[model samples]
Target: MSFRMIAQERPGNPWFSWDYVQGNSDTILAALREHAALTAQAVLIATVVAIPLAVLAYWVRPLTGPILALSGALYTIPSLALFAFIAPYLGTGTSTVLVGLVVYALLLIIRNTLAGLNQVPPEVRDAARGMGYGRLAQLLRIELPLALPGILTGVRLATVSTVALTTVGVLVGHGGLGQLILGGFRNNFFRAEIMTGTLLCVLLALVLDLLLAGAERLLTPWSRRRAEAG
Candidate 1:
């Protein structure tokens, strides 16, 4: 009648156990691996799309309003609601999640990209033009380099958001850390399930932030010099 009774039936089998996902070695490893893959895929796709759109928005100021508005709308939708809304049309799989992640990533990426470009002094652009550099050349060589720090900051935010939102993908039957939380919620073992999922998610995000920070340092060595100078 109760979960304990159900759990007793499968004694020592944590996977089939009543309280948790049985944390049996295989099940736990599988969940961890699945979550990592999904999160990586979603983040990778979002970065690809966001970087181009962000760069485009930076180059063409007029597009900023529309580009930002679209991303803003995506950000406004609650994660679960967004997944549910798209699941019908997209049919509940990784594709739907990818679309959602990209939409959410655009706002942060665009803003940061534009901000970073803006931070590049007007004189620099003028000097580049004063030289033989073409518009595309200046953008590729100068603008992107100068904007790296801000872009990385945007990436940091986007990464955190992606990790959080990916959890909701579970509602669509997609597995991630969200699956863990959802399973826990469904079973009503609030602490074990919720705690495990939440902690893992937090840890994942923090690790990503650290990695990105290290990457920013590696990619933007000039930024470190600038910091030292100031």
Candidate 2:
């Protein structure tokens, strides 16, 4: 059958009519919302879990080697296998997707968070101590502030990676922009729908990266001011 004939409105299947177009658009919107929600949830959970572990590892020194090794191993699990392994417990949906994403994000965020924290100059820490700043005070007022830019940079990277991986959820029956690409493939429609999904994902990543970059600059106004001065 011709493309038009195949895509054209049929009597009983609701996908063809103008009403269906509007509804499908709504469905896509809902899917996008779900995708964002799951991705964010995973990232936030992973960030909370990983950053502290990273901080502790950095502080402990003895545990650093083991922790890094563990994270690296987790990172090696192929996305598809990770999702499939979780399928029995989490089943097919956002939960499994979130779990896989959280695992994937841990190594990245933790490493970045550690690097950002460690980047604070030792002299600065000594100065803070000399000025009677306690550990908590030093971390809150000095170290974390200095680290914020790099932490935000890691977040931007994590978000973009999650967005791309969410597309893979289609394989395990989760829906998102991936559904668009899957539908296109199943229908043998070359690249039209696939391209649409790909472009949307890329654009979403770019926008997220820009927003995170802005947040970094906003949070580090002193750096920006110093740059202006120089």
Q: Which candidate's lDDT is highest?
A: 2
Q: Model 1 compared with the native: what TM-score?
A: 0.85
User: In candidate 2, how many Å is residue 179 off?
Assistant: 1.5
- Per residue, candidate 1 scores C-alpha lDDT tens digits across 37-144 of 776776677767777788788778899789888888878988777777888999978787777776777678778877888899999999999998998899889888
Q: Would you give me the overall lDDT of model 1?
A: 0.77
Top model by TM-score, which number?
2
lDDT of 2 by residue, 13-52 (tens): 3322454346567756666776678777878898889878
- Model 2 TM-score on a 0 to 1 scale: 0.86
Superposed Cα deviation of residue 128, candidate 1 (Å): 0.9
